[model samples]
Target: MHVPDGFIDAPTSAVAGVVAAGALAVSLRGARRELDERTAPLAGLVAAFIFAVQMLNFPVAAGTSGHLLGGALAAILVGPYTGVLCVSVVLLMQGVLFADGGLTALGVNITDMAVTTTVVAYAVFRALLSVLPRRRRAVTVASFVAALVSVPAAACVFTLVYAIGGTTDVPIGKVATAMIGVHVLIGVGEAVITALTVSAVVAVRPDLVHGARGLRQRLKLRVDGELVDVPAAAEPVAARTSRRTLWVTGLVTSLVLAGFVSFYASSSPDGLEKVAHDKGIDAGARPHTASGSPLAGYGVKDVADARLSGGLAGVIGVGVTVVAGSTVFWAVRRRRGTDVSPASTAGTGV
Candidate 1:
């Protein structure tokens, strides 16, 4: 959930800002190990896709709706470090451009949404993979469970944050109960979306899905009544879909989802907003600093048609997010390239 300004006091928010910055710094280094030529570009696409899917909020309960948090989906598709960065990029774009999240509370949102969700989801995913059968289907199953748990985990984190720095008179117990209850329903939607998206990617390009990598079991050969591992090169290689084709397809899908399909999404308030309004958590909420932006509230200024204005905003968001994400990831990838020692490069005859 996007925490708005004034929900948390300046001191708490400032501490959260430090935490978010520290996490981002760590993720940037970890991402260097995760990103390569293939994954770096895909990382950007995943961010844009997450941004698009988040716009299509599905009804979770009476007057409550939920959307993709993207932590599990992104972690499964890419690596966890990059996944955190992906969601963070979407949060930044939404805050500064669409004014969806508050600028003052940016750190709180990042801490709750990006860091907490990614860490918890990826941990659960890895745990499930360790216990479950190592098959392609298992990846999708783990993704569902991971996504399901991450939403509630985020809710719990937000509750704790509010408990510490809440500006209103609401009881912490009530806030926790309501936040967790609604988000539990929201988690179901998150699970389904994550599983379906991961399954689709695993089907088309299992190579691109970081969680599904190494899923193919090694071939065993019986030699002299003893089983021997077959050489990896002896296995038949599957024809791969080109990265360009996959990237183009993903971008097109994101455009369709945000530009047109978003119009049909539920108009009801999301899980956090509903909980806040009902539980008096928004009593101290302040207006977003970017509320005056032309694209504030996901609509273009001076664009008369609701459909056209929202569509343009969505399209522009996707475009900007992709470019920004790609730039960051490419720079990370380049840094990784330059990390090579000149002696090593010389030894390799590069």
Candidate 2:
């Protein structure tokens, strides 16, 4: 959930910001091992896609809706480390441009949404992969379960954060109960989206799916009434398209989703908004900084038309998120490419 400003104290928010920044720093290093020539290019697309889907909120409860949190989908499609960076990039773009989340509460959002979800989802995914059969189905199943749990885990984590540094004098127990209860229903939507997206990716390019890596099972045979291990079969190469083609395709898909499809999304308030209203935690909510901007509130600044304004804002947001996310991922990929350069190695030897 995108926690607004005034919910948490400045010191706690600052601490969260530091924690998120540190985690991002570590993820940058870990991403080097995860992203290669094949996957690095897709990483940017993943971020853009996440940004797109997050805009289309679906109905959950009577008045509450939920959007795709995307931690599980990103982690399984890309890798955990890269997934963290992807969601963070989207959050940053939404905050600084779309004003979807508050700038002052950026750290809180990152800690609860990016860090906590990614960590829990990936951990659950890895554990599931270890026990489940090493097949594409297992990956999808794990994605579903991981996404389902991640949302509630994040809700719990946010409740804990508010308990520690809540601006209001609300009871922690009530907050926790409300938060978890509402978010659990939201988790079902998360699971469905995560599973479907992961399944789609795995079907097209299983090789690009980090969680599906090394999934080809070893051969087994019965010899002398005992089971014996045979050599694992060589996995077939995926029909992966070129990075340029994938990027273009991904950006096009994101544009289609946000620029057009988002118009049909439910108008109901999301889980967090509903819970905040019910629990009175939203009493001190501050106005968004970008409220005065023309593009604030997901509408175009002077576009008198509702559909046109919303469509334009959505288009701009997708374009901006793609550009920003692609830039960040491309830089990380370029630096990684340079780090393993032959010329640098030759110089080192000399």
Candidate 3:
């Protein structure tokens, strides 16, 4: 649901921009604690993967479809703060490179799609994890529930934003009902994809999944009929594949999904698009500023072969997003390292 330019007026858009900026600033600071050698690179990969999977839109209702929002998937696989950054990176690439979303409405997209989904999904996921059995399957279950709730929550937020700043005359009540209704169906697809992806990663390397971090090899010993946590040294070395192998495999999977599988994605409008058309929510929609770019509309300019052009665009998008996201995360990690080094050196001097 990319809100094109003109859907919201200047003042509301500015306010949303401020909110998004603040959220991103907070995320950058918080991500330092979440990103490490292993997770920083994986976080970049997660962004690329989300970008790729989003291209493979699946049918929801008879005339509508939905794609992976990736908030819950990212939050479960990585950390929430990093997950927000991941989706934001993808949205940035989509707006500037693919012209998929509006540059003027970047804040709306970020606030609605990136921030709302990540925050809500992670909140629900953590709540579930706290109460549910601390098993690997429970993580997948939580991912499903989190994703299921996130999509509609995002739609609800969008409705509120529209109610306040919508450029059209649509009734707020009708817009909310339609947006939430269609997005609820879309939420099912989001849940399945998030759960399956989380399950697959957790299966291969539970240690790599941020949500699965402490759940693995949690040994409980019985002393005086009470169970106590085992020390880290007592835990056996996990039977795991090399990180390099997993990274390569994940990258290849993302490429395949975007370059080949995306061709088969449903051509129907997505839930938000359908709702917008039905409710006149996009009456004031303006053309994307980057409409003339070669990569605009997910196709190469002057390329007649639809499959080849789209595939190439998808591949290029994945490459660019990964590089961009990795650079951002690497810089953040390096800065974090620099900050820690001074403190460590001072402590050592004392």
Local distance difference test values of all predictions, in order: 0.91, 0.86, 0.90
- Which portions of model 2 miss their true places by more than 4 Å? 217-235, 240-245, 341-350
Clashing pairs in 1: none
TM-score of each: 0.94, 0.91, 0.94
Q: Candidate 2, overall lDDT?
A: 0.86
Reference-based lDDT, residue 70, model 1? 91
Q: Write the per-residue lDDT of candidate 2 for residues 194-252, one digit (tens) a residue.
A: 89888877777777789998984455689999987676544445646655766687789
Off by over 4 Å in 3: 217-238, 344-350
lDDT of 3 by residue, 1-350 (tens): 77788888888998999999999999999899899998888998999999999999999888999988888888888899999999999999999988887899999999999999999999999999999887888999999999999999999999999889989999999998998998999999999999999998888888889998877746789999999989977876445777788889989999999888999999999988898888887889999998888999888888899999999999999999999999999998988887786667785864
Model 1, span 1-350: residue lDDT tens: 88898889888999999999999999999999899999999999999999999999999889989998898888888899999999999999999999888898899998999999999999999999999988888998999999999999999999999988888889999999999999999999999999998998787788878898888546799999999989878865435677898899999999999999999999999988998999888999998999999999889999999999989989999999999999999999999999977977886768
The order by descending TM-score is: 1, 3, 2
Once fitted onto the true fold, the runs of candidate 1 whose alpha carbons sit more than 4 angstroms away are: 217-240, 343-350
C-alpha positional error of residue 221 in candidate 2 after TM-score superposition, expressed in Å:
13
Candidate 2 or 3, higher TM-score?
Answer: 3
